[model samples]
Target: MSTQTPPPVATGAGLAPLVELRGIEVVYDAAILGVADISLTVAPGEIVALLGANGAGKSTTLKATSGLLVADRALVSRGSVLFRGEDITGVAPNLLATRGIVHVLEGRHVFGHLTVEENLRTGTFLRRLGRRETERDLDEIYGYFPRLRTKRKTPAGLTSGGEQQMLAIGRALLTRPELVLLDEPSMGLAPIIVEEIFEIIAGLNRTKGTTFLVAEQNIAVSLRHAHRGYVLDGGKVVLTATAADLRERDDLHEIYLGLASV
Candidate 1:
């Protein structure tokens, strides 16, 4: 009755992807490629940035794994989605949450009418266990984002953009997800707030071995936190490199700066 990886993943650091994608594709309603055959992995203790421009297939890749888009409307089209070495092509999105993969969408989707505690409780949809365990995860999430500690009694709508983003993440973490698909965690925040959010993301990966596949338009911001990253160009993975290698490249600067064509 445990959804914890079926046979369960190796309970140690540096473990392989709680979830893996191989040659993943997503075709549009008009048969255009939203994401044309991209392969990536999210191993324990790693944070990978999925980066691109406005129309790049970064969001599509995240959607595919989360199983939000499936069949004719938005199909995998080809290849496999492996979670703990098991193929999970076209799995239900809700079912995925139980299986230890959580997706926090681009817009902070906290329940605006609800208190911070209520928003956090929503993550417990998968785990139908004791209240003590729920409280433990709740406290653990707060430990990561101490700003949320003070505002736990406030309604989510009253929170600022950055705090709302933290709420979105804290809610996801409350599920105790092994891998999380985070879409633009730094979007629409002040520069300082953005820095703080990314710092917490980096710390989570370091301390708890939380795996992340993050989609972000802010290339520099994502690069600084990611261990490795993929650059999606026109629905295809045109570049895959370590974050350090990416930062070292004048080619990257030229392309992103409109100084040259990639």
Candidate 2:
């Protein structure tokens, strides 16, 4: 069974970016800088990777874009965050989610007590879907992750790590997000699972026209799937390049060694 998904709503090259951060600076607790002077763009239907190691401000950047920083008393004290040409610098996270921006935060955050199906249902909190519509959406998510269907009745906390990751992403899809801000989809998963997740992500971008801004440390795999990448280190963007350029420059290795130079 196939439902007609909408074509990519993001316009052509001349159109504004789906998500743009212009010289944005983030601060934590009152004075600690998380990410500074970082600017990047995720064009419509594009998969863009924010590459860096732990504490490199990747998570901080994603949180800033998705309006999640407010929860931790962090703020984008400078610059701006734009969503499809509109200023959403400090919009509330729930509002952003309702506006077709979903953030799948780092660490699989599925509700422990909820069944797999229930977890998926929570993603539709913003949408007023009839029973048929909601079931159809659930089935669609199952198509992308068959393992989820098999484990649909199981408590989310009982699933394997890879299954939990799939649940996290599948839940996000239930929201029908135009843009998904994904953090560390590959973390804690086996290599085969990582590849599987990325393949599904690529398929979603192609068939559903979902744009992704993924924060990832698995450089080799991420660049393989991303259209473009930005390497961040110490709260700053060190390099921005197309995926092929990044591969050719061997920047992936440099990033691993903390030597990525602009």
Q: Number of the top candidate by lDDT?
A: 2
TM-scores for all candidates: the values are 0.87, 0.93
Query: What is the TM-score (0 to 1) of candidate 2?
Result: 0.93
Collision pairs in model 2:
none
* Residue 229, model 1, lDDT: 81
What's the residue-level lDDT of 122 in candidate 1? 89
Report the error of model 1 at residue 85, Å: 1.4
Q: Write the per-residue lDDT of candidate 1 for residues 161-222, one digit (tens) a residue.
A: 99999999999987778888999888899878987888888777767878888998888777
lDDT of each: 0.81, 0.87
Model 2 per-residue lDDT tens digits across residues 1-262: 1232223233324456899999999999979999988999988889888998788899999999999999989999999999989999989999999998999989989998999999999987679898899999999999999999999999999999999999999999888898999999999999889889988998998888889999998987887788788988888888888776776775566665687455
Off by over 4 Å in 1: 1-17, 30-32, 70-72, 253-262
